[model samples]
Target: MGTSTAYGGPGGGTPLVPSWLGSDGDAGGLASPSAPPAGAPTKDPASPATLPPAPPTRLAIPTPADGSRFTAPRSNFTRFAGSGGSDRASLGRAVSGYVSKSSGGARQAAQRMGASRGSGARLLGFLTDVQARGATEALRSLDLEGLAGRPIDEVFMGLADYICPNAGTVDEGIAREAFIETIVDLSTLGVTDLDALSPDQMQTVFELYATHAIEARLCNDIGTKLVTAPTDPLIALRVQSQLRDFIRNGVSDALTAARAETPNLTQDRVHTFVDTIYERAFGILQTLGDAEADQ
Candidate 1:
């Protein structure tokens, strides 16, 4: 593994892509633009990575003709992201479950966006569209490229500590404190009536949460607690309950749509998808549990 000059930077420690053309960002940040993940199955040529539609007549979200200003936070981000790991995973699952209920083009795009290789937040956003638009036109108004770092409270107020803060004198250290407050807010939201809204509507509720003033304040609170303790269990339970509630919503919606779209889609198949959503979440729930234990 001796790097002569080709891989070395100015002196020897620096390294650059073999070819010098564009950014090293494609297929998201998980893999090299030209390479797939190790041992990952190659996607079918027929189902290429191009903007493959989810349905023949799917209505897509209007993606920003250009990209959004949402760059993932730089530096100290590991601390911020790791602290919110449980929330990110749980939210991703909830969003994924809701979006997967559709049988049309929205479903395809949702699956693509929610792919394991994609960002947790991005997956949540695509899922948001499905919940907002319904299975039919869910994909019609997506602005995927425009939602980067939009804010966690956009979906979960407790997670607001993960959003844009008072872009003033606060540094990362102070912002992390603000994030702590967000955790409190998110904890409160998690405990709300999960059964009140349908799965799709519940996801919409999260979308609304992301925009409300309460979430912003939560972020401010977390920012005040910088290197604080992990979020509480009552909060964790609420988040978990929300996850299950979200799954219920998606399952119910999927069953309804399946009956209408492919008359052949059996109740059993719908159950299978619901189970899939639940199963995807088990790992996240475990992580949340562990975090609570540490507290």
Candidate 2:
């Protein structure tokens, strides 16, 4: 599939995801963005959806010492763009290791904060609900077959509530961003209509969402401010792009490995299944990271 640089960001138009993604639902505040009018036109094929950055508040991470901050051991990405040979391998290890560790820490922190459900868990819950009760019964007026008529983005916006519930936390925002990015990636693969999505395509969507969710969660935990941005604007963007691909590749591989054991999912086993995927994904990443470091 061809790639596009049309992703939404800081300077982009209105974000494709919900504006209230991280809102706490205060008395006078909105809990979600207003839906487009009933007859809104299908999304223009020529234009791609743009996703905004995650919420500004970051998950707290201890800063490394200034001297060691940019090295491969820490996964800061400072040396990743220009490195070669063993150096590139070391940088990859750092990226994988840092993401794996931060993902675990973020999960623990979310549990302690009473927001234990992440995007993958939430999405699994939705699937389980659909399984227990048919899609029409589960979603009331929106069956799986009905999705064929709507624009793909509209379907995504409607599904975001279930996939990335309003948690009022950085994690929720990261999850929301990941979900939007997944739609964009799907478009590249010619998945423009919701009803046309095949079984494998749907599985691919979930896989990619899990991949992006893991990477986005780790990046937010690491924080752009903590990682010293390259002085040149273009180099910084390139580094950011490369670093995302590197971390995403590791997570994607991990998920592929775990998918080998995927069972015929039941409502009762949904949570356990999603948890196992995450556990295995991180475990694989950590092992690969260690091997990379030792190389």
Number of the predicted model whose TM-score against the real structure is largest:
2
| Residue 259 CA displacement from its true place in model 2, Å | 3.4
Model 1, range 1-295, lDDT digits (tens) per residue? Answer: 0111112112111111111111111222244568654555555578866543333322333232111111111112223323444544434422322222211123231232111211223323434444455422432343232333334343333233323223232122222332343344544566333223355444344333222221122122222222232376454334433433443444334334533554343323433333333233332333342343344
Candidate 2 TM-score, true structure as reference: 0.59
Return the lDDT, model 1, position 292: 37
Clashes of each: 31, 2
Q: Can you give the lDDT of residue 44 in candidate 1?
A: 57
Candidate 2 lDDT for residue 230: 51
For each candidate in turn, the TM-score is 0.21, 0.59
Candidate 2 local lDDT, 238-258, one digit each (tens): 565655565566556655665
